[model samples]
Target: MPDTLYDALIARVRSSTKARVVVEAAALTGGLIDRGLIRSVVDLDRGEVDAIFDELTRGRVLQAVGKNRWRFHHELLREVAAELSPPSVQRRLHIRIADALVAGAADGTPEWPQVAHHYEKAQRFDEAASAYQKASINARQRGALIESQNHLARALENVERLPASHARDLHEVDIRLERGFLSSTATGHASAEAAAEFERCLQLISDEPGLALYATFSGLWSYYATRGDLRRATQLVEALRLRLADMPDWYRAATDAVFGSLAVFRGEFDSARAILEAAALAVESLDSAEIEGAWFAPNDPVAGMYTFVGFTRFIQGDLAGAEESFTKMERRCQTLPFPHGPFTLCYGHTIESLIRTEAGQTDRAAQLLGDVAAIGQQAGFDEWVMIAASAGANTSSRSPVAGGARDPAALEEHIQNLTVVVEAWRAAELISFLCWYDAALAQTLLAAGRKEEARDRVDLALQMAQETDWHIYDAELLRIRAQTHDCADAVEADLRAALELARRQGALVFELRAAADAFRWGGEPHRAELLAVLDRFPAGQDWPDLARLRSLVG
Candidate 1:
């Protein structure tokens, strides 16, 4: 438990974001503790609540019309107070108690029935629903499927009583859907139920302009990014960006941190760098009240926003920056629930692996990628599926597992993994990552003696890249096409197009690979010119860039 009333309030507010408003309600209910509005009441000493109220105003969790009267923030609490009905205190009480139970705290365990009594008194059905859902999870863990289903149905009943506009109703549904999805663990459906439920929330949010929208948007971003849909993911981000136009600097900074990975995946590296750089500067804002307030903060999912910023740093090839980000992420995860999920663990290891790989730590990189492969082999088809196959797919694919002196199984395997992601993305209709993946996979396959398969993959890669007008990928696709036809001098056009794009983007690896390929096919002047340029570059064991990749063709 937190030490002070302010700390408790902050923790509450941070968990649900809506709790920020609930904090005001909690105080109002406390106006007369004799009133049953505040239940399972714990003593926080006299003046502690008053101190919290004072900080509430100063913190601007809500605003005041006059000194005596106060309300929650207009953007959050105000609308939520009117249109969005919260679950009953009794119901929320049960959920909290269950959370305590999950945390292994026995003190709150015996209090569930009391919370249920209050819930029945207030007729707060939705909180009852959440409580039931929690009960279901607990029941299922104890191998009580019948009890779990009964609790789940009761939870659904709470959702039924409210109108579509009631955020509590919608939130309950989200909880139920997430729970159901996890329970079913759908193997064949690609977790479409989860994705579809998320989509529903996304649609509903367009009609609401309060805290629900923020919550919905955050969840949607995470869903789309994890599911590999960058275009929609981009829209979610831009929506957040537009919403933050006049928002406080703190919230804006937080949003940037959460969305950093989406931008990185979208290949907007410089833009990602800018967003993360700004977020990296926000760590100074942490304090005890604020830390406790993580529960109240809106749109602060992916705790240790800085941890994600560190990931962006990793993506951008900054080892020191990545280390800093990972450190914050590790700390923040300690405070949040199940901090290391498949997503976080996979990301952590991959980033560490890349850093080690780039720093000439082959043994370390091998250990990291090797571990990733082992864990990922069983996780089934989803994001990890894509990641497991794509590691070192580009540069090291041609080398054997440990980089054979002159063999190409490693490269072939990389291409195979790339093909897997390509097929998945094409099926998922995610064109951007799909295009890049296809182009790289084609090159890998071609180098590995799988010429026929390479041709088809290359054609698709070029088509998608051309369609998107992603010039970086487009050039690589073209050079590939030219090479396939043995177009000789015609290859220069493709290499030049790719070279110009790579130069502008600082895609050093891509540039080298394309030029190297051009030299191999076009020969003479092209070969001599590309080598001269390559010599000017510093030698720190560059990954198999385009220049190196092209050499594999010979």
Candidate 2:
């Protein structure tokens, strides 16, 4: 019945070829047409075109949206009218309409989606891909990362349909690189999906030297680093150094930041501090606008570089230095582009909060946690949300362990929730902080007096750290491991090892922590050793670890 009614409408316009042209124009352009678009495609004068549209509207086939525009009264009528034209004619009309729209773009920026749509319908894949890419960029500028990704996906899909050639391969590489960056921003740098995109780009990116290096560093090196594979990460750093040596000063600085982070992961605190500080200084000398275009990573390079510097300082017990670095990092975040800016801020806040909590500055920690949660929620970053929630679990007042409140069931529930979240992160390949999370979980378990479970968790964390050569948290983990053992001999051996490792790493904070744990566990036997580590801190500093150590000895 719908088809019969549509055919009657079409038959009414059949006597006038120009009127038929108007129906096809309305049908082809998404069931809507203005006088300009109709006049562009048809030979009728503007007045005649207006008359035809008015007649169509009066006949109930088209509805007037305004004085100059008309649309099909029903979608079914538009579909039937669109099909009335032969495929060849339809393709021609699509191209003509697309070209007219491009010509009519008053602001010089064509409506990319509409232009791409018409070109795609015309089987003009090249134009379609380019327009789609523009659309993707427009979406990205608006902070709609997911929408940007969809547009890029469409661009890639359309570009792939074109014949295979070197140019096509390069085009695909460009699209994939953009997609990889978006994936890294939306999910995580170490996510499997982001890795896959860069891996594919690496295969096709040989001709583009800059892009090849980016793919290798961002894809392969990042994957290994996050998964605790520091050996591979070191290898990649060496490769990056040689490739980057002659490039430029900025490249050298970027490489320094990368190597510095690797050093931090390996527990080489002193060297990591120097390298990261030098990199930060180099970046700090540049204007934000200069860094924005030159620094070639998904996130703000300076912010990330400073974050590692902050960690290095914190571990080395340079509390003031660490706070300064974190403040700098947060300040850098404000100038960054969308998604990257927010993500970097969230990440910096989360890590800073962890440090604050450890320093026993609960009020500052709470404020940072609030910042992290707000940024994560505003940016629609699920991983950030999970990470912030997980970080807060142990510190929340209801938890029996880290929190002052002692509800065993509440602590157990927080532990269970944290386990699920961290494991989910593991499943997603967001393993950059897996060891830290595991150790934290173990500490909470020990506080709850579940020694066996604590030991089990500590063992797994240690294994992961050893396997990946990620030793930044080894001293703390060892301290926790020592607590889990019931045998005095075993506990003494672990504590001694933890102290030695912390001292060698120049990780004064960890050394103090291990010393406190030792003094508490070994009583009088460990008192002298604990006092020696305590003297390393400046007198009268309000570090929670120091206060705890003082109370124990006095």
Candidate 3:
């Protein structure tokens, strides 16, 4: 036999009875020499254990680190000693050690890595998978996202070793759902990998509609929403509604929350408000027992419901209501165990920054946008960074009438930044965001007094909006078109079209803007029309657009 320290240790353990017992016990307990444990294992007194340690230390096999603590001089020696036992004996030892560790763990939650190792050594694949899964959950709770992902992969590897069955399929789907959620949280965008995982889950859960509904809400919705495929998202919503009466309480609540968000994206503020309110109430009423067995109930749909409602209220010129809803969303996210699930805090902050910018809190808006921009950049989320940059551009480009002087250099910088954002969106094929960014760019150009360039930008934005059927920004684009026109009749025609579209879409903020523009260009008759519309909204006196309109009228 080849001579090595490990070989020598093994040979010594095999030759001496005391050395064999001490080495076997040490190997069983993961190579740590517990003196009292050794005495108990070998049935030796304390003095005998000290004699055994002295002999092992003199032979360069064990080293004394502290009182009652000793370890093999080389870990490889311990491994070799562990292998000296027969295969059957080794497995039984692994089981015994694993049981002891489980019994000693606090709250029945063992140190997962050690538990996983022992279970694997004992050839218990299913138990190892469960241990790894627990490890992943523990890592996630500690905010070690990447480590959690690795643990999940290990769990899946063990899961694949199990025989095929309904339970096995369900376990696989659950793992995939968690993987998808984690992927989205880490990158701040829905990944194709996550979409594939969700698709796999759907295939596996075809017969279980309740689980399928959860998969659709958690996976399909995220995929279509992030891609800006509003038509597909709408179709999915319709399909879910067809089965609404059959869905469980949690599923119904989540579906309505998603539907409300889609409605907000489509500029159907009235429908969004009603649907979101129902969703919020439904989710709030869910009991812990009802959701105990859910595989992917990490996100509180109620928080998302409030967020969409807040966004809708902001667009409808209900600033106070929007602030209240956003505050609720913020508080809910803060209280959640894993708050950065579906809708992240950065997303909430972005909307809040936009509201502040519109409410004349430019400094506060800038600070909020800066915070999100840093977070986005750190996460490598281009879309989030782009949102922050776009909002920053808008905040920086405030005109003299808005209490800030226009800087030509700042306007040009905004155009450049927005150009980059537009190109990035185009590359991603995010048509909705691309069109909105185009409109934002045109607004910057208009503020810079570059009428011809502004007209070109707005025209492109309108064309893209039409091509994609993304009418959410149609009113805003039409208003910009009105500003680009030199002729009074062309300006009036565009303003009237904008006002009608905004009114039909329930976009009160855009309608107010169009009405103000109509009064500025169409003279006495248009002014009369503006006052008539303003007369219906007495509570809007504090709104930025309405406040400006009142000053102009006076």
Candidate 4:
């Protein structure tokens, strides 16, 4: 029925070739037409176009929206009219429309996707590719990651239509690199698709050493790092370091940041702290000229370095140092460019929450998690959202547990929710902090008096730590393990090992925790050790561990 109506309208407009031409052109552009655009594309005078527009509007085939604008009353009418033109004519019309749109657009104004749309329809692959890339950048800066990804995919498709050449390959490489970065942000960095894109980019790279290095570090190395494969990440960093003599200062500083993070993963807290601090300072002072052409960079180098610095300092029992580093991180994020602001903020907030939670400030910690979630949601990054959700659940769950509450049902409910979140994280391959969550879940289980379950959870976490070379959380797991056992000998042995491991890692926070647990539950055998650890902290810190230690021995 709709087709019959469209056919009748087409027959009526067919009386004049000019009217038919006008109808076909408008249909080709999806029935959207303005007098200026129609007059530009078609060789019709203003009065003649106005008469055609009046006839179409009177026939109910076109709707007059405003001055010089008209759209098909029904989309099907446009589709039917479009079928009247041959492919050759359709291609000519598309080229004319694209040229007109380009001619009218201002410089630096975002490329209208309509221009790309017409170019693609006209089989003009080169122009289409360029237009799509610009649109992708515009979408990305606006935080529309999915839209950006779509534009990039179209750009890549258009580039593939061009004949093979070194320049084409280079352009393809650029598109893939951009797409891979977007994928890592839209999906998780640990996603297999993101890894594959980077790998493909590396294979295509011939004369672009900087791009190759960028792909290696940002895409490949980051995939492993986010997946908790610290061993592979360390290997990549070491390989990059081997060529340090040929690299720029920014590359060198980025290498330091990556190494610092890997060091923290391996429980080398002191080394990690020094590396990250130096890297943060170097990155802050470097000029734009010194770092030009360096593609191997974090979203925000200064904030990225300080994020690791804060975490390392916190683990090493330097609360003041952690606080100072986090302050710097927050300050830098305020003025970061698009795509950097939310991500750096999320990283900074996550670490700050960890520090806040450790200092017995549950409310503050929860608030930070909320902020991280908001940032992630606003930025359209699901990884941080899931991270915030999982971490938030653990935080709220543990807050009550720390108050000496022993409601098994409530604790079980929390465990179930966390278990669901863990499954989601696993599905998304967001396992960077999987061990941390396991340790937190074990803590909750212990609070509910489920010693057997807690022990099982802690064992799984320890096994994961060993498998991934992620020992940063081992000391805390061992301390938790001490509580799961009923035998006095087993308890003392675990506590002693926890304390030793904490000290070996230079994790004063964990060391004090282990020592405090020893004094409280190990029959005061570790009283002197606890006192020694306590003496290392400043006099007036509000750390929960320090508060617990004072309450116990005073």
Q: Give the whole-model CA lDDT for all candidates, comma-separated.
A: 0.51, 0.77, 0.71, 0.79
Pairs with backbone N, CA or C atoms under 3 Å apart (clashes), candidate 3: none
Model 3, 445-473: lDDT tens per residue? 77777788888888877776665456677
Per the 3 Å backbone cut-off, how many clashing residue pairs does candidate 1 have? Answer: 13
TM-score top scorer: 3
Each model's TM-score, in the order given? 0.59, 0.84, 0.86, 0.83
Residue 1, candidate 1: Cα error in Å is 48
Worst 10 residues of 3 by lDDT: 288-297
Please state every model's RMSD to the true fold in angstroms. 15.8, 3.9, 4.0, 4.4
TM-score head-to-head 1 vs 2, winner = 2
Cα lDDT tens digits, model 4, 1-554, are: 37656766767677889998888888887656776788888998989988888888887888988877889888878787887889999999999988888887667463558888999999998888888888887888798888988998999999999999878877887787777777777766676777777777767774355545554555577678778788888887887777677666777887788788789878899888889988988887776233322332224556767888988877766777888888888987886655666777887898788778777777888999999899888888787897888888878777777888788887888888777876676676565777777877888888888899899988987887888888888998999999999999999899999999989888988898888888888556678888899788765566775576678888
Q: Pick by lDDT: which candidate is best?
A: 4
Error of 2 at 369 (Å): 3.1
Of 2 and 4, the candidate ahead on lDDT is: 4
